[model samples]
Target: MTTVAFIGLGAMGYRMAAHLPQHFDSVLVWNRNVDKAKQHAAEFNTQAVTLAEAAQADIIFSCLPTSHQVDEIIHQVDIKSGAIWIDCTSGVPDIARTQATYLKSKNVSFLDAPVSGQTIGAENATLTFMVGGDAEVFDKALPAMQALGKLIKHVGGSGAGFAVKAVNNMLLAVHLCAAAEGFTTLKAHGVNLNEALDCINASSGKSGVTENVLSQRIFNRSFPNTFALLLLAKDTGIALDLVRDAKLSAPVIALSQSLIQAASATSDADSDFSAAVKMYESWSKITLE
Candidate 1:
C-alpha cells in the first residue's frame, strides 16, 4: 500500500486529509500548529509528525492557500527522491511548472492538481480535480485523488492544473459579481428575490452563484461558508496574469476582478466569498435580505 503525507489543514484541507487514511495504509500529517495536527491525526488514524517526516512519504498532497506557499513548503521541507508531490493549491501556472521542473531534476515527480467543489465537495468526497503532469505520474496519482474527488482529469502536462484553476476562478469571480449585481438590480425593481432565483435557475441567467450561493449565503446574509474572499481576489489576479501573459482581451473579467479585489479589501478577508454581495449592497444601499 502507498504511504501518504497530506499537508495544509485549513478548512478544506482538514476535511480532505481526514478522508485519506481510509485509502492509504499510512497517512501522515504535519501542521504549523501541532495540536490541530495531532487532533486530526488522532481522528483520521494518521501520524502527526514534522515536515521532514511527512516529506519522506511516497506521496505528498498539499492543499495550501497560495502558489508561493506551495513553493516555499516544498523548498523548505527536506523532501527526497522518488516521492510524488501533488500540489492542490489554486495557484500560478508558471510557478507550478517551475516546481515540476525542479523536482524532476532530483528524480522526484510533481503534479499540480488543483481541486474544485469547495468545502462541501471535499467533505462529501465528490470534489473534482484538474491535474497537470506526465501521463505516467497522473496514472500513479489517480487513486489517491479518487479517494477525495469524484471527477479527475489529467488535463495536460506540467502546469495545466494551475491554468485551469486560474481560469475557473476568474469566471467564478465574474459570476459572483454578476450574481451580486443581479440580486441588487432585482431588489431595486421590487422583484421578488426567491421568484427571480427560481426563474433564473430554471433558465439561462443561472450559475453556481444563483443555484448554490445566493440562497445559502447571500440571501440569508449568514456567510458561514468557509471560502475566503481574499483568496478569490488573489486568484483573480493570478488568472489575469495568465490572460495578460497570453495577450488576451477580457473586459468583463477585468471589472469582476476589481470588484472582488475591492470587496476583499473592504469586507472581512476571512469571510466566505459570497460576502462579495456586500459590495453591490453597499453601492446600491439595498441589502439582499
Candidate 2:
C-alpha cells in the first residue's frame, strides 16, 4: 500500500498536506502541535501520527519554518530505508547538501524542493516547486509531487533548489525596499502616490510590488498578515549567507537585509511583511496612501 507522511502543519503545510490524501492510499500527518495534526486528520479523514511513526511511510514530506527545524526532524525520526524525503522549507543550501548526504548514507533519497506562490497557492494546490536532487529520483517522484504543485522544475543537484529560493526572496527584499524608498520620495516631492504607482506600473519600474502590494496592502493601509516580516527577514539573511559563502559582494542586498531586519524589530514576528514600508514612511514623514 502506498503511504505518505506529511510533517509540519503550519498555514502552508496544512493546506499542502490536504492535497496528499487524494494521491496516496494512506496519508499520515504530524506536527509539533499534536492538536493541529489531529485537527487536520479529523477534517481530511487521514491519520495523525507521531514523528517517529511518520518515518515509516513510503514518502515523507516536510514544510517547516527553516532548515534548522528540518535538520532537527531528520535526526529525531528513524526514517525507513528507500523512503524518499521531500523538503519544502525555505532553507539554507549548505544545510540541504548536508541533509542529502546524511540521508544518502542510509539508502534513502532526499530532495530539496522549496515552493513558491504563497499560502493562497498552497490552498489551491497551484504552487511552483524548485526541486534539486538526482534527476532519476525526481522523475520517480513526479507523479506524487503533481498532487501538490502545478509547476515543478528540477533546477539542479543537491542544494540548488534552496539556493534559488533564497536568492528569490532576496530579490523580493530588494524590490520592496527600493519601492518603499522611491514611493516615499515621490510622496515627499508633492506627487500623488496612486498616480506615481500608475505611471510606474506602466513603465519600466513596474513589478509585483508596484502592481499588487502597493495597491492592495500599502495604499489601503491594511497591512494584513499575508506573509510575515520575520520570515522574509530570515530568508534575506539566508540569501546573504549564501552570497558571503560564495565570496561575493552584494551591497544592495546587504542594505535591504539591514532595512528588513530593522523593520522586523518594529513589530511582532507575525506582523505583515508589507508593514516594512512603514519604516520608510516614518523616516520620510510621508505615507504611501
Candidate 3:
C-alpha cells in the first residue's frame, strides 16, 4: 500500500486532496496555514503533521501557488531517496526543470503535473492534468492521478507539464478577453448581452468563456472567486515568458498577457478572472448585464 501526503490545501488543492482518502489508507495533509491543515485532516480523518513528517510518505502531491513556494517546501522538508514528489503547481518550466534535476540527484522522483479546469473541475474530480516526467514514473502515479482528475496525459519529460499549462492558460486568457471584448462591443452597440451569448454559444464563436465564464459568472453578476485575477496574470506572464524564451513569434499571446497584466493591477486584482468582464465594461462604457 502506497502512503500519500498532500501539501498546500488551498482552494483547488483542498478539493484535489480530498479525493485521496478514497484510494489511500493514510493521506497526510499539510498546509502553510496550520489551522486549515488540521481542519482538512479532521474532515478526512487523516494525519495533520509537519513538512518532514509529510515528506516521509511514499508519494506526495503538491498544488501550491508558485515555483518559489514549491522550491521552498522541497528545501524545508526532509524527503528521502525513493520518495516520489508530484507537483501540480502551475509554474515556470525552467524552475521545474531545475528542481526536478536537483530532486533526481537526490534519488527523489519528480513529476511536474500542472492542472487545468479550475475549482469546478477539481470539486467534480474531472480536472485536466498535463503531466511531465519519466514514463515509468507516470505509470506508477497513474492510480493516484486517476483519483484526482479525468483528463490525464503524460505530456513529456520534466517541465513539459508546466509548458503545457502555460500554453493552456495563455489560450484561456485569449478566449476570455475575446469574450470580454465582444460583450463590450455588443453592449456599446445596444445588443442585448444574453441574446448575444445565446447566438454565440450556438455558433462558431463559442468557447469556454461563452459556455462557462459569461454564462456562469458575468451573467450572474456575482463573479465569485473561482480563480483569482492575480493568478491569471501570473499564468499569462508565464506563457509570455515561454514564448520569449523559446523565441516564438506570437504577437497575440503577448497582447493578451499585457491585457491581463494591466487588469490584474487594477482595484479588483484579487477578484475572480470573470471580473475582467467588469473591467472591460468599465473601460468600454458598456454593461454586459
Best by lDDT: 2
| Candidate 1 per-residue C-alpha lDDT over 144-186 given as tens digits, one digit per residue, 9 for 90 to 100 | 9999999999999998998899889889999988887777888
How do all models score by TM-score? 0.98, 0.96, 0.97
TM-score of 1: 0.98
Q: Can you give the lDDT of residue 66 in candidate 3?
A: 93
Q: Per-prediction count of colliding residue pairs?
A: 0, 0, 0
Sort the predicted structures by lDDT, highest score first: 2, 1, 3
- Residue 178 error for model 2, in Å? 0.7
**Model 3 global lDDT (CA atoms, 0 to 1):** 0.89
Q: Give, for candidate 3, the lowest lDDT window spanning 10 residues.
A: 267-276
Per-residue accuracy of model 3 over 36-154 as CA lDDT, tens digit each: 99998888777898988999999999988899999998988779679889999998899988998999888999999998989988888999999998999999998888999999999
**lDDT to native, each model:** 0.89, 0.91, 0.89
RMSD of 2: 1.4
Distance from true location, Cα of 280 in model 2, Å: 1.0
**Can you tell me which runs of candidate 3 are displaced by over 4 Å?**
none
lDDT of 2 by residue, 88-129 (tens): 999888898999999999888999999998888899999999
